[model samples]
Every structure is written in C-alpha cells, then in structure tokens.
Target: MSLIDQVLARAAADPGVRGVILTGSRARGTQTARSDFDVTVVVAEQARPWRHSTRTGTLDEVVCTVEALADTSVHWRRYSFRGAKVLLDRLSGGIAELVDRQATLTAEEAVPLARANLDAYINQLYRCVKSRRDGLADAALLDEQESLPWLLETVFALHGRLRPYNKYLRWELENFPLPDPWSVVLMPDQVRLAPLCLFPAVESLARRRGHADVLDGWGSDIELIRAFAGAAGP
Candidate 1:
C-alpha cells in the first residue's frame, strides 16, 4: 500500500486515535508529485508519543486533542483545515462538523474581516497611486503588489468566505468564482490590470454590507482613488 494508505490504516487501528484528518494540498486534490501527506491525529489526551508531531517518510503528522483542534479553528490557522478530509471520525461526525466550521465564516465574522481587508487594500492602493504619480516607480510597484492579496481577501469576505491561502488562490477562484463583476476582475488576465477600477466596486459592496462608515474613514483618499481611476478611463 502507499505511504498515506498505510498511515491512515494505522491511525484507524489505534484505539487512542479518535480521529484522522487529511489537510493541505493533498486534501484539496491539488497535490503535486512532491506533495507530502499532511495528517492530523486526534487523541483524548496529550500523552507521550501521541503528543509530538512527526515528519517522516512522506507523512507529516500532527497529534492533538479535540479541544486543541477546536481552539485552532477560531484563529487564522483555521484555514489550514478549510478542505480537510476526515479519514476517521470516532467522535460521531464531530470531525466533519469542525471541518465545515473551519472552511467558512459567519456574517458577523465576515463583516469585520471584510472591513479590515478593505482598509488594508485601500491603504496599499492609495500608496501605489500616490507613488506612481510622484515618480517613485519601485515603491509604486511594491504597493501595487501588496494590494492585490488584500483586495482578494476583501472580495472573499464580501462573499462571507475565508480567503484561501496564496497557493490555492487560483484554484479557489477557478472552482468557486465570486459573484459577477468581482470575479471578472479577479480572473488571472485582469487581476494585474486596472486595480483602480476595483475601488468603486469595493466601496459599493462594502456600503451595501453596512461598511459605509469605514469607507468614510478614508476621507479624501477615496476621492483621490476615484479621480485616479477616472483619469485612467474605462
């Protein structure tokens, strides 16, 4: 049997192992030939061998209790479990439920995240635009590059989804396109071009989602961004 199959079988047979979850690119079905199996083995307690994670012969293992895993679910690290595959769940579907929670965000959670991302994107975009106009080419390029990821985060938040990691950004976009105009610009062909055009759409979406006040906080920066886009033309 393959290494992963052997690992899963062993994990399943262990009475102490309450669950086994497959994560990373392997779980997402986007693994390259060089990809290693990322597995999480859940136990009832943090005892000897079960407590230490091991990386050996293509198997990358994390051993933790259910409570520890739950704690992880509430933080940014939760994204690691976004598409995790539960190979074994002795907890009667609890593992599956946890994975589901890890993959998405609630409306309350999404709004604050969206606001933060929108603020960050605007910060970078404003710097990029100002730098370009001031003849600071290198600085402009850096700011523009930095803004793209934050722009992506804002879009995902607007849809009430956690933004995928950079490695899975293209895969996420291809498999789960955002609504209409947003998706159009996020396409690989358009992502690098016409970033200024994004500000107006972001404002509209953020406003509709009760974030007009946050946008207002940016004050003249918003006006400057619009003017830059207008000058750049449709």
Candidate 2:
C-alpha cells in the first residue's frame, strides 16, 4: 500500500533481519520531493555484495544479487512516487533496533569526557582567536576561525569516541544524546560552541584524576592551521 508499509511488510517476513532504523532527511520529515530515503538495515553479519556495491545513485533499496535477504535498494520514488509508494526491507538481525537505540552519553559518562576535551582545547581556541585578532589582516583568518567550532565539536565528538556530525547539535543531542551536566535545559549551540572555548568547558575535566589533556600541548594549533593556509592561500 504505502512505501513504508510495503517495506515494513517485507521486514516482518525476514528472519536473518536483526534491526532496521530509518535515517536521513526522510525520517526527520524534512524531506522534499527530491530527497532520498536513508534506512540502515542491520544483519547478523556483513552482507558482502551489498557492502561492495558501488552504485552511485542509491542507498535506500539495493538488493544483493547473491544474498537473497541481503538484497537492498532505494524506493526510488521519493523523487518520483511522492507519498504513494511503500519501500520494503529485509534485515535479518535486530540491528534496526540497535540503531533506534541510538548512542547515549549519560551525565557521568559524558561530563568527564566533554570537560576534558574542553580544557584541552580552551587555550588553543583563545590563542587562535587572539592570533586572528593580532595578525589576520587577511580575511581568510576569519574564515578559518569561523570553522573552529566545527573542529572543536569534532574533537569533542572524537574525544569520547563519540559519533561525528555537523552543526545539528540539538538534533544530535536529543536523538543520539550526550552527557551535558551544565546545560540541562538548552540545546548545544553550535554557535555558542565558540564562546564555550574549552577553557571553562574543561575546567571540571582538568581537576579530575586520570584525565589527559586531549588537546593540550599544541599552542600553535592555530599557527599550524595558518601554516596550511599560508601554504595554500594566494
């Protein structure tokens, strides 16, 4: 009947299927007529053919030529079918449930890691920002500084072996979740990320035992960045 209905129907019949979770723009309901459906189907083991397929245009419903239940393909109609079609799945394990579970960094788990990352990067951010204020007659310094939040978030995400994502901090926090002891009420401001500047963020982290300076000891991190720009810039 519906694309989702057809897909769900197929998934129910499959046994190897472990879990299936819808993702990307489609699941979020922000999809336009041209958006593709992104569903992650999990199986007991990696399906070789599906994993190896190099088809450039699709990820929604590619069927493995060899691994029967392993066949996967995109509904291909979000671009053409509108809301009138149903996409099916053939996951053999509970992987979809695993995805639905999403990752969570509870207060205890995330606070320490976040604080550590913050401390390690704080002085670095200050130096870089200060350096930009001091030596950046060139406009590119501003651009580089602007990109620092992304870098900081990346470090924070990686500091705890966390998942990597972009500016969608709130969505990431609520859906995927993280340990944020201080900001119990507000969403993580990707913009505020700059102001957080790691100094205060890691204040708690530095005082604790066994914590490493995840980003410390590289004061010229900005200079290193500038080195790249100086080498690349015109």
| Best prediction by lDDT | 1
Least well predicted 10-residue stretch by lDDT in candidate 2 = 75-84
- The ten-residue window of minimal lDDT in model 1 covers 69-78
Candidate 2 is scored at a TM of 0.49
The TM-scores, one per candidate, come to 0.89, 0.49
Model 2, 1-234: lDDT tens digits are 766566566666776555444556675555677666555444455536345322234347543322322222231211111111123334333333223223333345445655545543554454455555567645534544554554444344334434334423455456545456422322545434333333333334333533444444445563454344344332
For candidate 1, write residues 14-125 as lDDT tens digits: 8878888999999999998888898988887775433547887577888987777766335566778877899899999997887777676888888888989999988888
How far residue 17's Cα lies from its native spot in candidate 2, in Å, is 2.4
C-alpha-based local distance difference test score of model 2: 0.43
Q: In order, what lDDT does every prediction score?
A: 0.80, 0.43
Give the runs in model 2 whose Cα sits over 4 Å from its true position: 46-97, 100-102, 106-127, 137-164, 172-234
